[model samples]
Target: MDHRFVGIPELTAVPRVAVVVDVMRAFTVAAWAFSRGAERIVLAPTVEEALALKEGRPGWLALKDGAPAAGFDAVNSPGLIRSRDFAGRTLVQKTTAGTVGALAVADAPLVLCASFVVAGPTARYLRAGAAGPVTFVVTGEDGRADEDLACAQYIGAHVSGGRVDPAPYVHRARNSRAAADLGAGRRAGCHPDDVELCLEVDRFPFAMVARREDSLTVLRPVTAPVNPAR
Candidate 1:
């Protein structure tokens, strides 16, 4: 299967084996929540909808949209998910890029939520399913290329096999002086620990899958079947 690069919104037509990456924050937060014992997480496309979801499920924690600006509950920060006392409660997350990306790919044949932290497991999840073109649905900054796309590239190269190169993103990420300039503009969102969490490789073997019910997207964990190749 030939691998192709597409914008986040184009993930809808991707074949059954597609990986979703929100490395900068979203998936990292989801993984953190799972680690924190959150029963489940509802991926809402927008903050308003997420809030509405909380109304129906009183115990779910809320996270607003993150884009040009951080929304109400902050940009789905891992700090928030980890810091909160979410023993048995669920989290309702709405991110401008991640959630929108999830919505766009709602019809993918097999969608697995992923990030660098669980890149190895995500790859295992894809390979175990079947041989099909895998699209890394990376959520970008309001249609603009950002870290998420690079994270997707890394995971894609990891799972898809063949000669892989990382010089592209390593150079870009290292030289990205935008942090100096955008610091004033970049919203106070993801926590410092979150940055570390998002960068980890093979931190876990869980694959988060989205299940559409009525309108909201419910995230559920899918354990990789024991595979020595993984």
Candidate 2:
């Protein structure tokens, strides 16, 4: 199994197994929502599409980042997501990087939505015998999203049969310019606490797998043993 890392611009080269990562609160919020019992999440590339998906759907909730949209249930903040009850409901999520990246590679045979929150479990799921040439899609713009790149490498190291400490990656992400901007209130509609939440390594014990469902890229959590017998 070979692992390749690529940024959003290089998404066209995505392989059979694509791990789309968004660490600065996109996939991290997704992990929290799943942990809170969300049935499934429908990823939309645009905010308009997310709201449209939630429109007239009784059990659907819409969420996005940067300025509240008309029909969104909440911003893409993990703090707000943690406080809400999403049990058995479907979430329609749109983000600048995460959702767009996932949708771009939705045609891949196996697409996993990734963040530090689900990093360990995601790696284990791949190591458990999923077909590869795995590609880690860094949703953060090419060369600028340090947090997403770190997460991709973190998961890559694990999938490569190496015992890599997650502390450095977490530290790198915490100090990333994106995190700095959010913490300093430079980025609106994003919470400062979200940076810490997004950097919580192995916070969830499941990997989020995305599947193409009609026009939506639906993600569902798949749990795997933390330390499977080798």
Candidate 3:
């Protein structure tokens, strides 16, 4: 399969397997939520929908909207997700980039949601599928640069069967105007720690896979249920 990294602007050219990356918060938070026992995640295109879902799901929790540059769930920090109890719950998430990007690319045949946390499993899932071009889309702050681009580089390296090198983007990512937006969340208030968490590749063993529905797409973790016997 042909795979390459492209910015959101060039997304139309390669629309088959569009892997949306929002490592710093959106996608990273999604991964963390799932890992914490969130039964399912509904990717809401708008904060309204996210809040609605939270209200509808009874036990469902949400990550609300942040500032102009920042995104939903400034409270949905990695630390919050990592430390909180979601033993039998689910999350309805919305964001400026990650969820929006996934919503925008809902028309694509195979749209995969990814981040550094699930990068390895995401790669394995792609490699195990049919041979087709995969486009790595970075959903940055205001859908621009740094975190998303860095994530794109990370995923791009794996997709191309090369070693991951995020240094180039990391240095540049630190200087991005959107960097602060990404750091607005709780875990991110301490930027360095958040960055380190965001850069930890292959931390998860499953990938969040999405398929188009009537007008929306459904995203859920791709993993075989644990066998109670094994």
The global C-alpha lDDT for each of the candidates, from Candidate 1 onward, is 0.64, 0.86, 0.67
Q: Between candidates 2 and 3, which one is better according to lDDT? A: 2
Query: What are the per-residue Cα lDDT tens digits for candidate 3 across 114-211?
Result: 87778767766776663578777777744567767766666666555635565675666565555555465433233335656666677888889877
RMSD in Å for model 2: 1.5
Ranking by TM-score: 2, 1, 3
What are the models' TM-scores?
A: 0.80, 0.95, 0.78
- Cα lDDT tens digits, model 2, 26-142, are 899999999998999999877777777899688799998877767788788886678788899999998888988888888889999999999999889888857858988888867
The residue ranges of model 2 lying beyond 4 angstroms of the native Cα positions read none
Ranking by lDDT: 2, 3, 1
Q: In model 2, how large is the Cα lDDT of residue 212?
A: 81
Give me the displacement of residue 155 in model 3, in angstroms.
Answer: 1.8
Residues 41-152, model 1: lDDT tens digits: 8887766777777777666677763432422344566655666666787788877667677767777767777766666666666667746777666566543455666666
Better of 2 and 3 by TM-score: 2
In candidate 1, how many Å is residue 124 off?
Answer: 0.6
Winner on lDDT (1 vs 3): 3
Per-residue lDDT for 81 in model 1? Answer: 60
Choose the strongest candidate by TM-score: 2
